[model samples]
Target: MTLTLYTNPQSRGRIARWMVEETGAPYEAVILDYSTTMKDEGYRAINPMLKVPAIRHDDRIVTECAAICAYLAEAFPEAELDPRPGELADYYRWLFFAAGPLEQAVTNASMGVTPNENQQRMVGYGDFARVIDVLEQAVGRAPYIAGDRFTAADVYVGSGVMWYTQFGLVEKRPVFLDYIARLQERPAYRRAAEKDDAALAAAASGDQGG
Candidate 1:
């Protein structure tokens, strides 16, 4: 099986990289730049959205970081990233929650787009505070998002928690920080981060030499 990941070190592609690392699958990485290669017609054929973090497995293409995580978990089940029997509910729940509501709320909040009570009804996440409260309760409930063991859910959710807290996009609640701390201990997480950091450094060096 041939698997290829198209990503940029500076984008949400890092989350996809982490999920790929968690799957323990052999794959090739094709790094793209936002201004040029990513938007080129050749790359647009792969993803019309013109975004990083898309993957091609054989002939099948998958885009979006959340979808990539879920796909990789199922694709490499031997890695045990897929949810266990009882974990299905929580697994999908928090996975979509992070992908949809959490992300929407955070992005809107970051752009100073708080919804009024009436607008909240139309917004899927209701309000930023509500989303944060629910998320806090979620991580506080168990060792992992899907229960006792880490699953693809944590990879997506943990990335959100880590990024959100780091940028102050969300309130740096203790629960969020603690949850991120647990995920940081994973070997896959560390490896993925180091790879991205090295990629970033390489890009910087190239720019300097130019």
Candidate 2:
């Protein structure tokens, strides 16, 4: 079955679009308006949360950017975006870490909401500083998040790094700068960016016309 991606250009769906590009998958992009289309019943059925970036492949539906990235990588092994069985520990580890701890840390810090000491213990990310340090060290240790070879983990983690750095939510350490440089060099990344940018422009034009 042909894949269908329900997405908004400015949303987290861009990450999924990038993953699809990396997979070299032939997919249909359904661009939805954030305010109206996302709340529609049809889209909501695919994602109960009424979120963008949901994908339907055959009879299966997948939501969440990280999950979609992993799914596409495994689904299209000819793309070789995932690590082999023996080398999957780092792949799963960093991917989940980015989706969980790293994401939460950056979100909380961006909103100026630091957890108290007790709250920190209970929080999955511990503290923002610790999360930052661990992620920085992990990326610095290797060329890619899952080690030497680029994997789906990099798609998720690299998106986080790019967004965080762009928003000034995370410090632009040499490790992050170098990693992003490598990611930007990929043709898939550039194609994804251009596609989303054009979508965004079209949406803006529509708004103006209305």
Candidate 3:
């Protein structure tokens, strides 16, 4: 149990897999069933919220997807998955911004609640439209989220963007489309996806042989 990842390939756990793939680190995966996995007393101890995609890095347990991605990237520096020192500031800024505000806006939009102008003033993300505009401006200006290079920040933001784009949950703005194209083309991402896909296929076959 060097690093234990409790995940469901179909959930936010995929984000953790992306990070782990970027790190090029060795870890074990424990696929869980949707019906009973979360309720098992042992899994609850790993994440009180009974969330998927929890990680155990040796003795430290990290539950949230973003925290797990950020921590793993730094913990395995040889992987070079984090922003360079100069770009680190913007990296942190957009990473959490996307994780927080962008997520809220997406979820809110799915529920059919467009914010009023007055409510927009108080909400950090403003509205779904504004969130798209802001992210478009930043990503369009730089090749990657953190200036010139890909980082752990991209891993999180990219995952959110990619999913939203695929599901039509977010608008297919040029910036969003281009960003996902680039992220998906990365060798590391491709490799990780292949592994996860295989694991999922195997699990479906009732083998879980990996």
| Candidates in order: C-alpha RMSD to true structure | 1.8, 1.9, 1.6
Error of 2 at 67 (Å): 0.5
Q: Kindly list the per-residue Cα lDDT of model 3 for residues 1-210, writing each as its tens digit.
A: 388888887789888888888888788888887788777998989888887999898999998878887898888989887778899898899889888999989999999988899999786788898888888887787889988888998989999989988899987888888989999998888887887788889878988566
The residue pairs that clash in candidate 1, if any, are none
Alpha carbon RMSD to native, model 3:
1.6
User: Tens digits of per-residue lDDT for model 2 on 1-210?
Assistant: 789988888899989999999999899899987788889898889999998899999899999999999999989999999888765999999899999998988889989999999999888888999999999998998899888888888989999999999989998999999999999899999999998898888887875221
| Per-residue accuracy of model 1 over 1-210 as CA lDDT, tens digit each | 999989899999999999999988888988888899999999999999999889999999999988999999999999999999899999999999999999999999999999999999999999998899999999999999999999999999999999998998988888888899899999999999998888888887875221
* Local error of candidate 2 at residue 158 (angstroms): 0.2
Which runs of model 2 end up more than 4 angstroms from their true locations? 207-210
Worst 10 residues of 1 by lDDT: 201-210
Off by over 4 Å in 1: 207-210
Clashing pairs in 2: none
TM-score of each: 0.97, 0.96, 0.93
Tell me how candidate 3 scores on lDDT. Answer: 0.86
Model 3: colliding residue pairs: none
How far residue 19's Cα lies from its native spot in candidate 2, in Å, is 0.1
